[model samples]
Target chain A: AQSVAQPEDQVNVAEGNPLTVKCTYSVSGNPYLFWYVQYPNRGLQFLLKYITGDNLVKGSYGFEAEFNKSQTSFHLKKPSALVSDSALYFCAVRAFSITGGGNKLTFGTGTQLKVEL
Target chain B: GAGVSQSPSNKVTEKGKDVELRCDPISGHTALYWYRQSLGQGLEFLIYFQGNSAPDKSGLPSDRFSAERTGGSVSTLTIQRTQQEDSAVYLCASSSSAGTYYEQYFGPGTRLTVT
Candidate 1:
């Protein structure tokens, strides 16, 4: 069984400040981590993913995530937050299943990001 | 190109009724998935289909919940005798199942409200 956790329900940041949304995961095999953002009443938009590359992965909307194998964490980060960045963010994990089960993502509860100007 | 899409953005139904949610995956994408989001339970995987065959029905909550896909293009999730607890935002996503990186694109989701 694989799972993900977003400890914070909400994160508030001032404009132009750096922001981070924490995520942690547990998987039997190698963890394939991903980050997605959802605007109000909109579907989730893929942000970035960490498969088997550099620890730091860049993504859309000037967002990035650092995958730390030792910590089992993939935290979403942005150098400078913009008010438009305020939205709901989710972290998900996918693990290789020998069962041949189609890749199904296990997602976290989601963290609400609020950027104030 | 167009992204994944779901029909009936919002739905309201009474307890004991049945509801169907639809999803159209991206063209030529062989994989489709269903999920649910609610206040109590974040996002949950409901099922996964590959070329109209479901190898994983593991995430389905109960027997009352069922889903099927046809023509390898569209899918419909059905919930029978819906309970209030069943009310949630139903999300659909699809991936090409190709390459080393498999990222699923999502649809807006259908919000179901059971009374």
Candidate 2:
């Protein structure tokens, strides 16, 4: 089984300040991690993913995330925040499999980020 | 090209009623997924369909929830005998499973309110 944990329910950050949303995972074999953002009355938008190779993955809207294998964590980060960036963020994990049998992802409870001016 | 699309932007049904949700995945995408997002339980995977293979229903919470992907393009999620607890936003997504592409593009989602 695979599962993801987002420790914070809400993170408040001021505009132009850096922000971080933490996520951790537990899965058999390796894991494929993803970040998504949901705005008001909108569906989830793909942010970024950690497949292999680099630990630092940059995504849309000037957001990035760092994958730490040792800590089993993939935390979303942004160097400078914008008030428009306020939204609900989710972290998901798909267990790695060579045969491609695992198609579904286990998602975290989600964390709400409130970026204030 | 168009991204994933879902029908019935919002729905309100009485308890014990049945409802069906529709999803049209991106053209040529071989993998489709269904998920539910509620206030209490953030987001939960419900089902998955990949090409001609059988669907993965392990994530479904109960037998009342079922889905089908027809001809590998469009899909439908049916919730039978709905209860108040079933209220949530049903989301649909699609991705190209060929090669190393694993990003799942999502649809706008259908908000279901069971009263």
Candidate 3:
């Protein structure tokens, strides 16, 4: 089974300061990790994904994530937080092989990121 | 036309009433998915349709919940005898295909409030 874990329920950071939202996963095979952000009354927006490449992956809105195989983690990061960046972040993982079943994503509980001025 | 669209942005219905939500995927998207976001559950995948086939339906909570996609473009999710617990934001997403490299685009979501 493929599963994701977001340890933090909420994270608060001051505007212009760097922020990090933690995420980890467990999968049977190679993992395809993804990060998505959702604002109030809106849909989840794709941030970035890590398939098989460099350890660090950059995404939209000045966001990035680091993929650590040993730690089994893919934490989202932003060099400088913006007040408008406040939203709910979700981490998802899917296994590469679909022999057991189909390719279905397992999402984490989600972390609420609050960027204050 | 530009992005995935869902109908009935906000729906408030009495308990035990049946409600149907619609989703219009991107013009050429071959894959569509439905998810529910509740206060307690966070985000849960409900169903997924790839082209004319749905290989997975394990995420659906109960038999009362059913969904179907036609012509590989439009989808409808129907809930029978809706319960208070069913109240949540139902989101729809579409991707180019059921591939690891494809990115899923989301819709605004229909907020279903069972009162």
Candidate 4:
């Protein structure tokens, strides 16, 4: 079974500083990793995904994630944090296989990121 | 372009009562999904529907939980004899297709409170 693990329950970062939200995964085959952000009372917004190629994937709002196969990790990063960036972050993973049988994503417990000014 | 929409942004019901949650996917989307978010459960996949085929209902938790998509555009999730444990945010999402390459767009979610 494919699963995602987000070790941090919450992360605190000062405004304008770089921020990192950790995520790791366990899967049998190649992993399709994704990062999503959700603000209060809003739906989750897709940040980026690692399908193929490029170990470092860049996404919206100056966010990016590094996909490390050896470490089995896909950690979300931002060069500079903004107060508005405070939200709940989720990491998800799915395995690549025939029949696309695993369309259902296994999501992590989620991390609450607080970017303080 | 309007994104996926869910009706009754918030619903409060008593235990043992029944409730229905609706989702309107993107105009041309062929795949729809329902998920539940509880305090500790994270996101639990409830069901998945692809095109006109039989839905993948493997994720549903109990027989009391059922869902259907009509005209391949809108979907409804009904829970019979709701329990307090069923109180959570129910989210609806839709993708252009069930392929791995397609991204799923989520709705704001309906916050269900069973008291």
Q: Pick the candidate with the highest DockQ.
A: 4
Candidate 4 scores an fnat of 0.54
CA shift at B19, candidate 4, in angstroms? 0.5
Per-residue lDDT for B15-114 in model 4, tens only? 9999999999989999999999998778988999999989999899999999999999899999999999999999999989888756788999999999
CAPRI accuracy category, model 2: medium
- Residue-wise lDDT of candidate 3 within A1-117, one digit each (tens)? 778899999999999999999999999878899999999889999999999989999999999999999999999999999999999999999888756354667899999999999
For model 1, what is the alpha-carbon lDDT of residue B98?
A: 29
Which is the winner by lDDT between candidate 1 and candidate 2?
2
Q: Per-residue lDDT of A1-117 in model 4, one digit per residue for the tens? A: 988999999999999999999999999888988898999999888889999999999999999999999999999999899999999999998888787688887789999999998
Segments of candidate 2 deviating more than 4 angstroms: B98-101
Model 4 chain A lowest lDDT segment of ten? A97-106
Docking class of 4: medium
Better of 1 and 4 by DockQ: 4
User: Which clashing pairs does model 1 show?
Assistant: none
Please report how far candidate 4 places residue B60 from its true position, in Å: 0.6
TM accuracy, model 1: 0.96
> Candidate 3: which pairs clash?
none
How well is each residue in B1-115 modelled by candidate 1, as lDDT tens digits? 9999999999999999999999999999998889999985789999888774544789899999999988888999999999999988999999997232599999999999999
lDDT of 2 by residue, B29-100 (tens): 998999999996888889888889888888788999999989999999999999999999999999997333
Where does candidate 1 chain A have its weakest 10-residue lDDT segment? A95-104
**Poorest 10 consecutive residues of model 2 chain A by lDDT?**
A96-105
